[model samples]
Target: MGLLDNVKSKLSPAKDKVSHLAQKHEDKIQHGLDRTAHAVDKKTKGKYSDRIQSGTGKAKHAMDRLAHKDDDGGSMSPPPAGGATPPPPAS
Candidate 1:
């Protein structure tokens, strides 16, 4: 295997672990995201409400994808169209 394939193979288990953890704590994660967004919005005095909401929605969608929880609560692969593009990590 090429270096890329080797790297992917090595990382596969870690990725699966992450997916499992994300699924197991899906609801708590969702709640945390919502609560965080609300707190930030409040701190900003609604100045960034739109952006905050958008980001929150994207985060929830991503968590759903990671948990293999689709709209119908059925397992699904990563979204075929946009894919599960995570946002840049916060500094």
Candidate 2:
């Protein structure tokens, strides 16, 4: 096997274990994501509430996909055709 393939083979077991652990802790992760976004909003004095919420939702969705990679790799569905694009990440 090529070097990259060999590396992937070695890492597959670790990846599976991580996915399993993430699935087991999914609820905790979701709660923590919510709490973190809420706290950030509070700290920002609600100035970025909408942005914070949107980002957090995306993150949770990504995590869900990661924890269930057999379905899809942590991807949020594409936004509606007419919907605004998500803002770029903060620098």
Candidate with the greatest TM-score versus the true structure: 1
Worst 10 residues of 1 by lDDT: 82-91
* Error in Å for residue 80 of model 2: 13
Residue 20 CA error for candidate 2 (Å)? Answer: 0.3
- Candidate 1 regions with alpha-carbon error over 4 angstroms: 69-91
- Model 1 per-residue lDDT tens digits across residues 1-91: 8999999999988978988899889889987887788778777877777788778877877777877743456555443444222333343
Query: Clash totals for all models, in order?
Result: 0, 0
What do the candidate models score in CA lDDT, each in turn?
A: 0.72, 0.71
Error of 1 at 12 (Å): 0.7
What is the C-alpha lDDT profile of model 2 across 1-91, one tens digit per residue? Answer: 8999999999999989988988999989877877787677767877886787678767776666768877654566653332222333453
For each candidate in turn, the TM-score is 0.72, 0.67
Q: Give candidate 2's error at residue 28 in angstroms.
A: 0.7
Flag regions of model 2 displaced more than 4 Å: 71-91
